[model samples]
Target: MFKHAIAAVLLASANVAAPAVAQPAPAPSTAQAPLQLWRLDCGEFVIKQYGAFFSDTFQYPRGPKNIVGSCYLIRHGDRYMLWDTGLTDALVGNTFDNAAQTLRLRQSLVDQLRQIGVRPEQIELIGISHWHFDHTGQAGRFPQARLLMGRDDVELLRGTPSPDQDSTDALAHWLNGPGQIQQVSGDHDVFGDGRVVMLTTPGHTPAHYALLVRLASGPVLLTGDLYHFTEQVANRGVPPFNHNRADTLASMDRFDRIARNLGARVIIQHEPADIAKLPAFPQAAQ
Candidate 1:
């Protein structure tokens, strides 16, 4: 019953494709040659609650905060890793709208992957940013791949979610299934070369984490929920619904420190402006 209400608020809360970044045509791709990163358009959403309600977590919540749901696909050598699964394709029928803004599904993630010649079986790993419903919508689709998640969040899957269409319920099968799961505690180097690493950034959830993808172009950081919008970066605002306020604040400081040290370009998962920094789908960021 505790998480059931969260499901309701989430469903109630929450489009636009950021314009593509200008860049030269991508280099030719090979299975073992180039590292490829593709950003998929999972879905889009806008907050509908009044200003006072949103102000609890946001600094300037004057209007409906429109944001996009993003997922990523990375190809390293012959191995493939999926960042976040995005919203469930099955639920694409329901359109969300408010007087201020509206969000509709432009495409499905499975379809997006298919466009890039990636089959579900070709996915070697599925790394979830957190345990949110939107992020885990398509996780169960890849049964052959291993699931990587925070140890703290992995432990949360032991119980049942309120029948209110919770994400915990959507991801429960994979969480409890026969597939292998890597429960990470702190920082993790995915390829052990520092090219691809998982940075531990909490606050949105107990075990929420982020990803760092290095390419020939530069290093890119996928901020899970550390800062949903670019404004949150400067404001350093904590949502009212976060798991731990102090944990969130600490993670923010660390998140910025590492990026500054490496000069990484931070990409907020929900911010459309940040999405514009990446090459559009079908164009790998390598």
Candidate 2:
């Protein structure tokens, strides 16, 4: 049902054409960036209750219950960093809306960021795990931030068009206009020193990526859609829907080993239980 809804929504959205003209270019800034990272829930951004559903190979387990989508805010010095923007405000209330409904993103990602005291302008960088609409919804909102993404994902977004033309808008804003986009070929150290590192974890998408944050508790690996929940990690189960099965399995194995070796906590983006364990913003508890 969720998959069907998503397909319908994508089909409906695909009718709209992307802008023909390019946006202006981003200006280089020497502003001192801040280094405080905060994780914001941004409310439930998806609706698919993929708790029990299993993928074809059963390498991973579906969550016990439905999972809620999430967005993260990283503060570096004075500048704000956004990881995986949630669904757009326009689609927040529509029940029949596929991406909006499945992701359960009732609140605007921009609004949630502001609620935590960071405005869009303060954002210096925006990193995406993949080009999925749910993860890239608010990319256009941060025109000033340097958009960081895997090269393959960028290509995929550029190649596709949707109802809102979100991918086109993001690319146009990042590529054509003043938006500074840094297309990394592979993994990148967000702040250098391993405080926050972006790893290329393909499989969910050809260019899917994961984030590693060295929090006070320990290192936290943000597995964006790689595995919907901890059960997926424990049981080695994949979601019914994904771009590639083999790649997803490989990425999961990599995550498990890396976390074990580093004694890091793996935070699955869609798992409510895992998210509950983390300390909310303003109060950082491991």
Candidate 3:
């Protein structure tokens, strides 16, 4: 009986898995290339009367504020996306000025892209934060790229003429070919990997959105007119032309919460001061 028991114990010990040697995580699958972001000099427009045009309650100081028409180029692996086309290239030589502001473009977006060996055709997607003229000015340049915009804004573009409608010429390509438009209703993850996302924060327009780019350096939040200037972040100032004041306030609160949670670098696209958060043009944030 003792000998039979000893044999059973030996067999059980041999059958037991040999301590299940742990292999070193299979080398992590050659981690995907880091994402890259480029700040493009789309154009600039000086708000002649900041208080009159920007703040509905005249919260900001009274002075001419040089609001930048900033654009961004994001590269994830091989795919590329352009955010906010900025003021029209035509504004380069002839600075268009009205009672509210003066729009000017020092360099064309195409030329800027050319400097970094990126062509208009190379862009896979064009992200419009809003349908304003300044943001969609150069959108026509990339007709082949998919248009990702707010659903409400898209409806406005397709509906009858309204004050919110700009020339509509820049978006004529997408307008004519509705197939190319992606009418985003809520937060959108551009790459599915969660590297690039568009957060819907409407107020400035019916469907305005802010972009969140996850970079190796850190996350970045591109305020798509959510807060034109940094001051709006603190004061929760809503522009006089905003569609809904309550929605704007809520969006501001949400934006602040997100930035705080992610420890993100917030870049007010129109604010000249925010430009320094990223590297100068030609160079990229990776």
Model 1, span 15-43: residue lDDT tens: 43454444543332233346878888877
Score each candidate by Cα lDDT: 0.76, 0.69, 0.83
Q: Is candidate 1 or candidate 2 better by lDDT?
A: 1
- Clash count per candidate: 0, 36, 0
User: Can you give the lDDT of residue 175 in candidate 3?
Assistant: 77
Q: For residue 255, what is the lDDT in candidate 2?
A: 79
Candidate 2: lDDT over CA atoms?
A: 0.69
Q: Which model scores highest in TM-score?
A: 3
- Residue 170 displacement in candidate 3 (angstroms): 1.1
lDDT of 3 by residue, 244-272 (tens): 89988988989889999999999999888
Task: State the displacement of the C-alpha of residue 156, model 3, in Å, after optimal TM-score superposition.
Answer: 0.8
Clash count, predicted structure 3: 0
RMSD of each: 15.0, 15.0, 11.6
Candidate 2 residue runs with Cα over 4 Å from true position: 1-35, 43-54, 58-65, 97-103, 160-166, 175-178
TM-score of 1: 0.82
Misplaced by over 4 Å in model 3 are 1-30, 164-167
